[model samples]
Target: MQDPVVEYINRHPNAGWKADMNSRFSNYTVGQFKHLLGVLPTPKNVIEDVPVRAYPKGLKLPKQFDARKAWPQCSSVQDILDQGHCGSCWAFGAAEALSDRFCIHYNVNVTLSENDLVACCGFQCGDGCEGGYPLAAWQYFISSGVVTAECDPYFDDAGCQHPGCEPLYPTPQCQKQCKDLNQNWVDSKRYSATAYRIASKPYDIMTEVFTNGPVEVSFSVFEDFAHYKSGVYKYIKGDYMGGHAVKLIGWGTSDDGVDYWLVANSWNRSWGEDGLFKIARGTNECGIEEDVVAGMPSTKNLVVDSAVAAEQRASW
Candidate 1:
């Protein structure tokens, strides 16, 4: 039997996105899919103390730019991270963006730990795992910097489990310390963003990505999005789930000439074109162009000597 979501997508004659029944999300109920989306709180104003670099103007930007291609050193580009059943996409998106920016800024590659933020960042960011806000996650980065994935690996449930199946995953708790899976502790000062900012306009978001690296973006996820395989996604028909966040890495036109923003998702590599999806650009389909947040890595954090010295002095 065809899933109702699949049938809805298949039946839509002019739907801009293609639907795939073979994907893992084919049988997910609307409620189950909606549960995966986390609520994003309103973005707080930018911190005035942090230095904000003005983006260069009058320079021609390429019609397309892929952060992965431009900075292959960033392993996050090739890797597809999974948030499992937890509604921690907010943390994942912001952490991934910061990871990319850290790499671009320092020319060093390292995966920042979303688990660190998801579990350690308290109510100020949002409820751990249950839901969170991307902007709040970035703000958390500014106040309490996060650690690397090597120090605090993701502890959420894996996506291979059936959609409705409960995997006995415990609620995440904030440790507020940097420790690896083996329980070895690392210096927290080595991995944390000094500041963050929100970019709403489409051009601003693009400029941030081109200049800094990927930026965290949130958008409304519809039921039909579960079946997205390829092509530029435009909302066709589906229940409106709450907002979901992802890392916006680049933008370009598809072979069919449809414009799209390339985004990295936290749903695992098995879903949505190897855990990456593209949505309609310019029109801000699903409010993607509206809520965008990014962060800058603290230069002091990038320097091992300074970071270690600061850690010793408990400065950060």
Candidate 2:
């Protein structure tokens, strides 16, 4: 007889219900999914000891960053199958982007704490593993200040809890009754900057904005929750992912010459191809430009070609 879990996944449209462990998680009932939703990981991971310094002024942009340059070299996103067993793709999206931007700004590769954002930012914007907003979360981080390290993760799980788990910088709690609409705080200095004007593209905008500093982007990843051990991913049948999270770093191309946005995933390093997966460009998921924000050179100060700019601004 066919496995019941496989049967359920098969019955699901696009096979979206397949769990990371097809054999184990495949049989998860709705109640189990709900239970996984609220439970937090035990041990929080710690942030690497790094100095939070001012962003370097006048960083250069590549001649033209596209799928050609984005996949194999600049960045990568592996499916973090079961970090929290919670489906909070929103938190992952913000945390990963910050990690990449932080690393790039400092020219160092370090993992930032996703649990910090998930636990603290949840009340203000993000959902507890069930999904949340990315841009709103970024605004939350910018206002809240440096997050606690992963070592003292907020949930109760073995993943993040460790002797070293603690925030490297001061972590700020959310302000009640915030006055900023769009839930964003305006910076007088940034308001006067040129980069603020160019943050319009929603796809690779994270890469652009992160080049100046860290920015967050959100998208859905619930379909990735099940049977994620395999490196080869085939879009499932009925598995309906109601939006998840991941972070954007840089762009690179896959071995297949396909353009992909590089992302950092929190699903431990075991899931997809050693925690790196390439996603299509120009579309929503890995398309970093889909959720563009302001104040980055690539995003803000594009030396637009006269013709293209004129064509676009004709309506003006």
Candidate 3:
């Protein structure tokens, strides 16, 4: 059978992107695919007042920019994380971007725990895997702090072992202790020194990514998005599914003369152009430019002093 999303996209050759059913969503029912769209609108907060920076005067952004190229040292920016069948994109987006920022600022790679934010951030962050607010995840980063992957890791994947989708997964229980008995939960937590929303202007967001690292953005996901394959994605057609979150790494103009934002999705490498897609830029086509959130990770927190370590060891 022909996939309508792919068929419609193919009918228009100049759409600047292609579509096909041979994707991770090929067998996923619409209901099942919706599980990944997990970002909710965060209410106006003080975070917006703290802009990453005022858009600099005469600042020229390159026509082609990609974060992976700029920060080869940062492995998080390069890796495409999977959200599995869980709607924890909100947590994944924030966690992954902060992980990238930690490496960018400190020159050391540390994979912070998305599990901490997903399972731990309470009602203020929204309903966890069902859906969550991006800003709240950031607030949790500073307030409660997130542990390293070794301490928690992502547990949602283990529950989604089949190719077909299962019922909506509930948020896992918060684990105050590390998975490994030897690790101290408190000391393993990584804190962010600061987190804030970037100004909604195109260049301001660009400067934020250029100077620091990747940022997390939530956007309106349409039905057509599930079938995207290559080129720059613009909402060509489809019913509104829900709000979705992803990592924004860079921006560039595609060969079709369409300007696009380079984004990394958490749907795994087998999906959507190797887990990365370029969406229409500057226009906020999917409300992407409006909700960029990132922060300066406190590398100091990643270090566990010998005194604290000894105390934890003795207590254990």
Q: lDDT winner among the candidates?
A: 3
lDDT of 2 by residue, 1-316 (tens): 1245445554556432233443434435644443333212211111122112233335555533433133322242222434544555555555555444433333333343455555566545535454445544545555553232333333534443356653121223433322323332222101001112123243335335434444444343344444454322344433443433454445545454545555445555654435544444455542334444322111111234556445433522
Candidate 2: residue 12 lDDT (0-100): 58
Clashing pairs in 3: none
lDDT of 2: 0.40
Please identify model 1 stretches exceeding 4 Å from their true place.
43-57, 160-170, 177-186, 189-194, 304-316
Q: After superposition, how far is residue 161 of candidate 1 from its true place, in Å?
A: 3.0
User: What is the C-alpha local distance difference test score of candidate 3?
Assistant: 0.83
Per-residue CA lDDT of model 1 for 1-316, tens digit only, reads 1367677776777776778864555556556566578765654543334444345466577889888899987786667788876778888888888777666666567788888777887777777767887767777777777777877778764563756667434456766555545443445433445445545566767777887788888898876787788778999876777889889889998888888899988887878788889898889898888777776676555554555445533532
- Candidate 3 residues lying further than 4 Å off, grouped into runs, are 45-53, 163-167, 304-316
How many steric overlaps are in each model, in order? 0, 81, 0
lDDT of each: 0.73, 0.40, 0.83
| Candidate 1 global lDDT | 0.73
Model 3: weakest 10-residue lDDT segment is: 307-316
> Which candidate, 1 or 3, would have the higher TM-score against the true structure?
3
> Candidates' TM-scores?
0.85, 0.50, 0.90
